[model samples]
Target: MKSFEYLRPETLDEALAALSDPDAASLGGGTNLLDLMKLGVAGPERIVDLARLPGLDRIETLPDGMTRVGALVRNSDLAADPGFAAAFPMVAEALLSGASAQLRNAATVGGNLMQATRCAYFQDPFAACNRRAAGSGCDALGGANRGHAVLGWSPACIAVHPSDFCVPLAALGAEAEIAGPSGTRLVPLAEFHLLPGEEPHRATALEPGEIVLALRLPAAAAGFAGNARYLKLRERTSYAFAVVSAAAALRIEDGTVAAARLALGGVAARPWRCSEAEEALAGKPATAESFAAAASIALSNAAPSGANGYKIVLAERLLARTMAAAAAGTPAEMPALPGSLMDDTGEAAHA
Candidate 1:
């Protein structure tokens, strides 16, 4: 086991200062970081604990109707917020769909954003994982590649990011408040995460020592409110990671879709929203046939890895369902594929 220095700074500035160490990593909730540390996947020389830092645990709503979520706020609290759920049901459902209740209670918003990929090869240091160790090559590309990415994947790495919240955030056009060495900056949530190309090690656009202060969810524009849903397809019913998930919001006036937002998870290196899909839905009827057509257009460019071609079909089906459910104010239905796609274990069936 590797040894490391643990620093618990009381103030935000102190915590940010401690994170300036080149080999340091920030710890919030430690649900994800501690596990990686135990597995030797994360070997930080210093851990800057941000759990006790002040001014980052509140969920405040402003006069402009925008909501500011502190990075340290627990997932459970965020999901349980009455105003948040009423205004952004899709985002609330996305948060609730992640992990078990116990784990969600302990995990922070920022920690979830920084959670590493759950690729089998990335978890095992002995395996050839380009994300874990640069230039090591990726074993998932040709072996046990069923759970790998179907979109935004490169030859260097096929791992998909694991985040349910990111899907809704991306679709909602949220922004992140980053505190860095120079000063503070607000970055759109869509641009916060990076797609793994040759540099899979760099999971996020977060610069070294740049601390995430908060996540700001802008108020939905007029006519774009309430009609939204988050649908996650896992190997099992609950408490499992998504094999495919969709976050969808639509404004249907006179039975026609005025505007739409659709973002996908578990299919790409980062949560992805297709402009083509949104465009296809615009000025179209909000019917099942229309939804299916838009979904097909959304994944028109999808290039699935071997064994994961099922994801393309599955994503389209789920996308259509999510759109219908959101329009009806109902939750999405589950497991649209054959029984062979998922078993009792809620894990990918590896060969």
Candidate 2:
């Protein structure tokens, strides 16, 4: 890895000042940043370590009843928080489903939100990638792109966001609290990630010198705790990036869907929220047929960016299955293998 000047800021102001240097990059858990640096995909001239920033590792319920998750909180810590897991089980499940135990233990929430796509082209310094280098011409466009994207892709890029945690966050209407030179602001998590249009290099809504402070889930988001599920399909049973994933939640009243939240992952530049699908589920019976219709609507506009047309059908079926699992009610305890379809049977699918 290229040598860089490292600064451990004592305060948020110090961190922001350090980041004002355009070549400086913030380091949280160093899980993703370090790897990118090693691969030579990213080599910032300076590193501003945020580990010493105080009060950014707590999980608390705000005065307004919203759950506030500090940006520096580790993934494993957040997933294992009793109150947080109970209130937002699907979010917890999504976190646990990602990476391995070692990674989850060290990865911070802010870093996860800032992670780059796992697209091979972007990671390979030798490949021509629009996301990695503006106007370089996307090699993935005509290369091995069976897993590129099925929605919200442009000729400039076909890479998909790789965060499992963000899917549930999008479904539950989470908000990101950002701190910058101009002070703090709240942005909807759905808008935190930008879709690749003509500029694939601009990935997130974060401005220069801005840092993610925390993520807040509104009090109303907890209402689906009893009926929320995050389901993922991957090449392996564990420790793999999702091929397609869905976060589904429903508020049922008298066997009817009173409200619904749905989002898809590994298929778009951001966690693809299915607002139309959620609207279709309202007042409908909590049945498989209702879920199927919603799923169809969710993937209606999804056209493959490359050879991944199968993802559209796979995403639809997975979404419908996720909705059915949500309607069945959350399990009393987290599954041994969270997000595994076979876990629904209350038996271990792998040794």
Candidate 3:
């Protein structure tokens, strides 16, 4: 084991001071950070614990219809909040569809937003991964890339973001509240996460020592009496990383779509808001055919890998099914799909 220094800061200012050092990192829930550190995928000389920071875990509603969620809020608590359930069912659904109960209880909102990708190559330090070592070359590009990216990829990296919360946040037009040594600022959820180009190490738009304080979701769209769906298509049914997931909020009028917000996960380097799919759905009849067509528009630009070429087909079917279910106002069971990977616990791995 590698030796490291640990500091528990009583205030955000103290934490910021520690994080000012390039070799120091701030720990929120330590769910992802600690695992990566143990695997030698991430290393920091010193770790600043922000658990003592003031007013970072509160959740409240604003005068507007928007919900303000603190960065330090636990995933389990966030999902169970009555206000969150009433105001943002999509967000709640996304949270509940994530990891096991234990993990959800320990994971924080800030850590969820800042969590690294689940790429097999990137997680295992023994493998040659560009994300772990600069200019080492991405071995995932040609080896076992079934669960990697199909969208927003670059020559340097093709790993996908692994945040369930981020997908719903993007579809709901959530904004991030950030504080740093300089000052505080709000960034749109779409712009908060940086796309992979040449720099795979740089994840978010946050500058050095900047910390996310809260997430502010926008007011309701024109519609949504109870019409929103977050669908995850993973290898298993539940408690697994998504293969090609989608979060869609639709406004339907007279059996036609008036407006829509569609965001995709597990297929892109970031939570991909499919504006083209939204545009295609608008002014079109709310039918299975229309949903399928919209999904086609969403995946038109997808660049599939050698092993994951089937994602394109799976994504379309998942999108169509989710849209149909939402339109019908169906409240599905926790594990709805039969033979789902979510149910394949301790079973033999499928080839």
**Every model's TM-score:** 0.92, 0.98, 0.92
Number of the top lDDT candidate: 2
The numbered model that scores best in TM-score is 2
Question: Each model's RMSD to truth, in Å?
Answer: 5.1, 2.3, 4.6
Order by lDDT, highest first: 2, 1, 3
User: Pairing residues by index, what is the TM-score of model 2?
Assistant: 0.98
lDDT of each: 0.82, 0.93, 0.79
Q: Write the per-residue lDDT of candidate 2 for residues 1-351, one digit (tens) a residue.
A: 899999999899999999999999999999999999999999999999999999999999899999899999999999999999999999999999999999999999999999999999999999999899999989999889998899999999999999999999999999999999999999888889999999999989999999999999999999999999999999998999999999999999999999999999999999999999999999999888889999999999999888999999999999999998888888889999999886884221110
After superposing candidate 2, which stretches have Cα over 4 Å from the reference? 346-351
Displacement of the residue 17 alpha carbon in candidate 1, Å = 1.4
lDDT of 1 by residue, 265-334 (tens): 9998888876689888999988888888999998988988768999999998888877876676433322
Per-residue CA lDDT of model 3 for 1-351, tens digit only, reads 366899998887888898899888778899999999998888999998888888889897779866688989999999888766656666777888888889999999988988999888899888877777878888888888888788888878889898888897887788999989999999988778887788887888889988888999877742463667677877666788788887778787899988888888888778988888888899999887898899899899987765887887887777666676557652433334321334322211111
Q: Worst lDDT window (10 residues) for model 2? A: 342-351
Indicate the TM-score of model 1: 0.92
User: lDDT of model 1 at residue 12?
Assistant: 74
- Residue 346 error for model 3, in Å? 30
